[model samples]
Target: MSDDLLNAQNDLARALVEARLLLPSGVPGLFGRGTVLEDVIERIDALVVRTAEGDGARAERWRFPPILPRALLEKSEYLSAMPQLAGSVHAFDGTVQDHQKLLARVHGGEDYGDLQKQTDVALVPAACYPVYPIVASDGPLREGGRLVDVFSYCFRHEPSPDPARLQSFRMHEYVRIAPDADDARAFRDGWIDRGLLLLRGLGLAAERAPANDPFFGRAGKLLAVNQRDQELKFELVCPITSAEKPTALASANYHQDHFGSLFGIKNADGTTAHTACVGFGVERVAIALFKTHGIDVAAWPVDVRARLWAP
Candidate 1:
């Protein structure tokens, strides 16, 4: 590469490092043992599964692979919600001949293969996108649409100095659907209190307030204002690092018929569906828990500590 190109690449790498936000991946993201992060992940996943129990809602195994359609993103208003936060889906597509050649070279550990681009797909910015397609493909929804619990590894483009605000994060989202606008709104409204209750049970000092999407441009500003004023969304938050303020650890949102209309999701009678979601940021909540309980998990409040490790 030319000197200018080399310098540009260096700058980009440096910029990424500065954005601790993307540190979602580990120096060893697979951390185990008595680490604060490990404890948090365990309790959080348990809560999600336990919360799902007795409900007819579905539960799928969790894993991460970045792949989804561009169309679905548009329908969900994801791009408009946070344009820069979306991560690009990538693949390595090589010709048959190229593959054979690379295989031959690697046979001797030569490791000389060009990583040319394959197909372009969008990175899963949220857990619910893939689920939406799965639900919609069955044609219009049956009866009351559907309610699903999904968890996904998501990516954002920002870099936060705080490792907790990583560029990549795990999100656990519960989506509710209904044929009527009132039903959907009720579902969204219900989660606000429930989410706060869960937070308190976990021993965090949490509160609810209207929130924004970090959208861009003048239109985004106006959209945010409208959403806040209309109380279409709310956040469950508590201080993660400092007592001065708090971060949004989770959100309850009402998408109305926006997604249902776009993706052709319909009711049993075939009318458009109404959608709502309550999302949990597993890592961010972990961060909050650590701050609330201290790095020393053993020393946490008796009830909270027992509940966390209880059988």
Candidate 2:
């Protein structure tokens, strides 16, 4: 990024801090949201729920903890696909002698990294990861498959000065499990329009375009290219930080049989199911609203306020 763009992002970050919308924790990309910011986020979430209801989507709501079993994450192949962004939990599982050694190192101002051991649980990388296993366990799907509403606090290892790119964030998603790839693709496509409409309803200048995940390594580059070529992913982006390179506030992805095959989710005919999800970055959307309509929610346009805050 150019210096000018960096400065712009920095200025926005400082402005948000000054307005007390974001409480700094002395860590980049990690913040404790102020009450006003939290209120905006909750209102946005409620608006999403209302929109989904208006669309006649009878989605089963599921909420999951921030961490999932490490084995499950491995089974999902997230570590292989985006190892750079994965966050694993670690604990101090040492004997008394080891504890004494750790204490000595701490007192001596030496590194104590070796004292911690990897735990069985890892931070959830996405909101939809936990849904597939439960769906699979419920046995074969019915004719229309299943629609689930899931939300979770997700974690990625990226630490940045850009407030839009948060390390710890909330993702609200609606996942569809279908009997075939065509169904999954169609579901994702429909959500692309819905997502764009929802964001635009909030008075955001949101745009939809083909996109791909930031897979890791050289092999990941090939995977990303294939994803784009297949047009399997689309993002609703807004210029919260910079217009030259907008941030993705929402994404729709068709994960063709990847989760189904791994988790043994099957159709009524025993064929592996296909899956798709539309995810909204809750904090990013709130940030965009604040950036677009100013920090004061009371001052937002009447129509926008009604869309979000009204009954």
Candidate 3:
């Protein structure tokens, strides 16, 4: 990160805080949002839904909790790929003596890490993780496969001063499961265009480009290389805090039989289903809107406001 880019991010963060659009929680990348900011997020989400509807996407809607079964995470092999970003849930399931020890440590301002035990649930890392199991449980998919609309609050362990990189954020996703790889690839490719148009329609200067996940370690680097080589992911990016290094506000990904194999999802022909998903970072889009047009929503361009607010 260049000094100029860092300065730009800091300035934007301060401006949003001063405008009461972001309420600092004394933590970087974690803050409460003001009503206007939240309203913008809501409008953006609704606009995506309307666009999906207009495109004849009759997806099954699902809203998931912020956490998922730890077993599912293990089955998905997410820990192997990006354990550094995973947030595991832990709790104090102990005897009375252990409780007394915990309380004593609390009073003495000491660590009580030994007393807590890992729970069955873990914070959801992505909006689409929970959709695979449900789709699998329904048995083999039909001839054409399925489309699902899912929304969830996602968590990652990254702590950054850049406001665009939030530790906890909402993701709105549309996932498609198909029997053929071509269909799955087509879904992702189409979304790359649609997502770009949607953000640009919101008066944002957004661009679409091939991208890769932040896979960890040496082995993960190889995986990321293969992913990029296969053109498995693409992101719609816009300049939120820094124009030089834009933030990815949305992504279109083609997961070829990865989730299907793990979750036992299959097609009518007894082959693993190929999957693709397009996800939007709701809060990031709202932040991009504020950065692009001005913090004051009422003073935004008439056509942009109409697109977001008009009935």
Candidate 4:
């Protein structure tokens, strides 16, 4: 790693320590402070498992696999969508203190003995960040395109210490890649409705609203605004957290021809694929549900309970 990069990581490590993040004793049951988040995850996991039966190996049901390289991040234009949120991953092999060890060591200014080498690569900011390259390297698909159930345990460096805003969470995605624009748009729309159905089933008040990623710089700012106005990106937000503020639980992103063009992902005849993804922040939804339905999972409405537990 470059000296500059190493310094940046060390600085970030220090900051995380200051923030009471970088939990080494293992993240508490805190993110799931109430049992409702865990229960919601149970529902989300069941849904993911059902979705994954057809996803081949990339499915979260099988196993959480090694995330693809950072190079793919460039292809998917994720840097433009969420540059500030992306996690930069690297390893520590040198004799000096590494970022992995830093997580545990910073607590008392003392190192954990027998610290193991961190072979695991970058921190994941979002679950969808891993899927594009895997599809790219798996060779070209048939003209019809492919759909996959991609999900993961993701992490983010929060700008603030809001319990509602966690530093780590589970993310779920129903991603579609099709040879034509219409199919991708259709898939994006399909998930939007499904998300609303889930919300309604839970008796939570949520609506689809235009949203943009936290992109960096002037061009990114304009791009976000344009995207929002055009309704290129939309969020499923619940107005339960506060009377004036709604919590966003899911997102539908229409990537027009972005990923296909960047990664040369095309059909058998070499037509570029149009890509779209539906993203669900599992914990966020659970939090929203908790606030909406109260902390007692057992007391949740019979209809919502059935939907959550339904096959």
Score residue 27 of candidate 2 by CA lDDT: 97
Off by over 4 Å in 3: none
User: Sort by lDDT, best first: what order?
Assistant: 2, 3, 1, 4
Kindly list the per-residue Cα lDDT of model 4 for residues 1-311, writing each as its tens digit.
35554454345334433433333234422232334346567786676455445334342222254354666555566677667766656544545555556666867688554354534455666666566666777777665677777677776655433344566677887777777889888878877887787766678788987874667799788888888776777898886434345668889888887778777777777777888888888767765666567556689888888878896
lDDT scores of the candidates, listed in order = 0.70, 0.91, 0.91, 0.66
Candidate 3 minimal-lDDT segment of 10 residues: 49-58
lDDT of 2 by residue, 1-311 (tens): 78988887898899899999999999999999999999999999998877677445599988999999999999999987899999999988999999999999999999887899999999999999999989999999888888999999999999988988899999999999988999899989888888899999999999997785789999999989988888889999999888978999999999999999999999888899999999999999999999999988889999999998877
Per-residue C-alpha lDDT of model 3 across residues 43-156, encoded as one tens digit per residue: 999999887885454899898899999999999999988999999899999999999999999999999988999999999999999999999999989878889999998999
Candidate 3: how large is its RMSD? 1.3
Q: Could you tell me which residue pairs clash in candidate 2? A: none
lDDT of 1 by residue, 1-311 (tens): 35554454344333333433223244422212234455567688677667655345554444445557766666678877678777665455778988787778878788563544534567788787777667778786777557887778777777644545656677888888677889878877777877787789988989997885788788789889888887888998886544444678889889877778877888778688888888888877776676567555677889887766778
Native-structure RMSD, model 2:
1.3
Weakest 10 consecutive residues, lDDT, candidate 2?
48-57
The residue ranges of model 4 lying beyond 4 angstroms of the native Cα positions read 1-36, 47-67, 95-120
Estimate the overall C-alpha local distance difference test score of candidate 1.
0.70
Ten-residue region with minimum lDDT total, candidate 4: 24-33
The CA lDDT at 197 in model 3 is 87
For model 1, give the RMSD to the true fold. Answer: 7.8
